[model samples]
Target chain A: MRKGGVVVRDVDSEVLQEVVVLRFLRNLFRRKDTVEYLREAWRTKPSIAVAEKLFHRLQDTGSPGAALAFIREAGRAYPHAQRLRDLQHQALRVRSSEEVKSLRAALAANPRPEIYARLGELYRYLGHCEEALEIAREGIARYPQSGGNYLAIGLVHYSRFLKTSSAHDGLQTEACLRQAYALDSASFKSLYYLACLYVYAGAKPMASECIARLAELMPGDNRVADLAQRAQALPDSPQGTAADYFRLHEARAMEAAAGAPGRAEPFAGLRPGKPLNDRLARIAALPGVDGVCVLDRYGARIAGAGRSGDTACNEAALQGMLEGARVNARRMSIGNFSRAVLRSKDWQVFLYELEPYGLAVMGGRTARQDLVQRKVTEFIEECLCEEQGA
Target chain B: MKRILKELNRTAGIRGSMVMTQDGIMVAAALGPDLVEDVVAALASALLTTVKRSFNQIAAGESLSELVLTATDGKMVFLDLGNAYLVVVAKRDLALASTMVEIQSAAHRIKNRRASTVQRQTAAAR
Candidate 1:
């Protein structure tokens, strides 16, 4: 049987028939805003499952960027909602191919502020600085109040500054970053970049200010700690004034640009469809592997995959143990605690500190701990290199 | 304690500060009305206790000078003061090093004052 000229074999038996009806009406009336309003209504309700389903539908209809925007709107009502936060992270970790296709399609079909910003980020990540800047400008033009677009523009300019050592570019980057921070003080990206730019500019006080804000935004972040250390290391007195420093920096930038050499694209070997979690899952699938996880400096699991019965308990234990090691290291004046390996007759456990994050691997006694460690290091290097390369 | 905390708050980004006993009692605080000083004290005390235990178990030595906890909304720094702890709440962008230095100085003053008062009480008893 058919209703409203659409096949409906079990419309009455559907779980969210209202969604189906809404979609039908939306299609019939060709009114996108009506459906968006309904989606907003659904968001106000505390239904994670429905929200997840609608999120998937939104992704299917639009793109990950669109899905991100929808979830961001939903997030206002449920600020501390964990699932929504996880979904947002998932959207950000989009497979490259899928992201590119969807972003292009989304922009072509119906461009929105988030799509433009995200696309600009992807371009920046891929080292297409010119394209990234163009997209950022378009995004700014479309969404004047959007701090993220400004951040993207700032990042692009910062990257150029790194390449050419241009004082003008550095100033532009700083201004854009400051604007971004002014608009949205809560964002870690803007604050982090501002701190970094300040440090490079030898503005210790300003750098310290940015670092403090970043620490609050992402507590226990190693990057913030590193910036803090750098700020502390700056001398109380400098030889030159601000103008003189910029002039010197410009001279150096010109010299470096004149000797420009070919370099590989950032994220050179990072193919689409393989995120850090997927990579960990692959490692877990190796023979004799019991469990593997990626953790932050604080020992909180960023992602993990395992066959072990007590994965959560093991991770928690490791976290506590790592904290103990760090404390001991600090007391002993032994510098940073990099790695710890525990081997017993039954199993072997390995923990490595990948700055800003940690990698924990555990397996049976007969397992290839060496190979696992190598793989972990390689994966970590790839991520770091991607970040630095960009 | 109020005077010290108020002075600390004069520095930009310092939200508030409090003094709490090791047993989780709130001695004094300069926090805002929206914040429950007692609850913060209790949580800080509990966290410090956990840190101490972790240190003991690891044999990392006895002197646990301070604790810093970073969260999304704010940062908390707990300075150990023998019988009590000083908890400082500040925004993410606050100058942490200088603030820590200021707190340590204030903590020293509190300890000395308490020590002198204890000595006077002992003399009176004699």
Candidate 2:
């Protein structure tokens, strides 16, 4: 039998009979008791079909949080169930929209500073930059001393700065964040954003000061430590903008989703169109390029082409080199480790951090480093574009 | 040797300079107040040791002539000498192309100084 678009085979007859009874009860009474019964049935039987039905019933009953929880649990148990994951994402979007609507209603009924700040932050998270800015401006106009509104404004401009790399946006971000910090020196968010801004702007002294303040505030916090490490490893010339950073993170999340035993069409736009190996192969074919490989943070080869005969050994060595560089860079408080060039008599090896993955390209010593760097940039851009278009 | 490091430290944006063995032992250092001599030496040694091991594992009979690590806040350049490595730490804005000349010159002077000292020891023994 087909129910809720999920095939109902392999289900026990007793369970199916119970589900039928619950459906009848739901249709007749539409009571909370019916939902309880469905939940009980799901907990007892725990089949994919039942889980889907339970999720729909939960949503109908206006318990999206419960529905999301159930769907996520089902997703983990039945990793092959793409339908559940889709429903989960759908539920999240619906829930967020519903909350937004309610929050808007609440603000319309009674305008308040916190609400405006919150709405602005929500809009920012949703990538509604204009709306976020508008809301934050409203909040600032009413509650000029509210650091939250200033932070929201700063973040919107920071996101814009990341996207546009405009000097004005950068300046606006700095000004807003500085105002926020001045309003509340002990605010963790304020300090964190200031530190991130300084680090990106290559203002090492300012970045270091903010980081030091954060360390004092949260002495044992791992995030503070991570921030410190990032400060040390920052590249001399930081590249990419907010869009690039978010896209890479989104791509990684989708990759994890793809790993589950299900179709990943929901994230099709962010999935890579071509296999990474094919892309690496194209890079290897570049003139004077000896080899190319992508290694995970741990140094495991994710993909490669034109590698030497001792691929395993070479990968291990590369991993070791990356680790050492990362450690040293952090200890020195440089920024964040971006890239390194290893030179020998016969070859030059370039290693780049692509966040969760690292790209290593080996080229003959005769190759123009600038040309090789350009090719690598092209390859990275292609990967990002393919992911966005896929 | 210390004088060479001190001179190298004078270069714009260079915070400190040091000479260390592949094993992480500090021979000499001219570091800024913000830098600790022991910490810098230890870190440099650890990095060089790892790089050297990587080269050995490849077994390609190739030795690293130079390594440059560029971070967001600063940059470190390592030049291989026969017996020790010269490690220089500078700010991110360090004009590497222009500053490398002075750095290389300082490395050369250190190498020459070591060579002369070895020669003097050999002559004394004879």
Q: Of the candidates shown, which would achieve the greatest lDDT relative to the real structure?
A: 2
Task: Give Cα-based local distance difference scores for all models.
Answer: 0.66, 0.75
Q: In candidate 1, which residue pairs get closer than 3 Å at backbone N, Cα or C atoms, i.e. clash?
A: A212-B92, A212-B93, A213-B92, A213-B93
Q: What is the lDDT of residue A98 in candidate 2?
A: 74
Q: What is candidate 2's lDDT per residue for B1-126, written digit by digit as tens?
A: 998899888888899999988777888999899889888888888888887678656537688878888875789999988789899999876767789899899989999999999999999999
Model 1: chain B TM-score relative to the native chain B: 0.88
* Per-residue alpha-carbon lDDT of candidate 1 for residues A197-240, written as tens digits (9 for 90 to 100): 77766667777777877887899988889889988997664655
Please give the DockQ score of every candidate, comma-separated. 0.01, 0.34
In CAPRI terms, where does candidate 1 land?
Answer: incorrect
Q: After superposition, how far is residue B8 of candidate 2 from its true place, in Å?
A: 1.8
Instruction: Judge the docking of candidate 2 as incorrect, acceptable, medium or high.
Output: acceptable
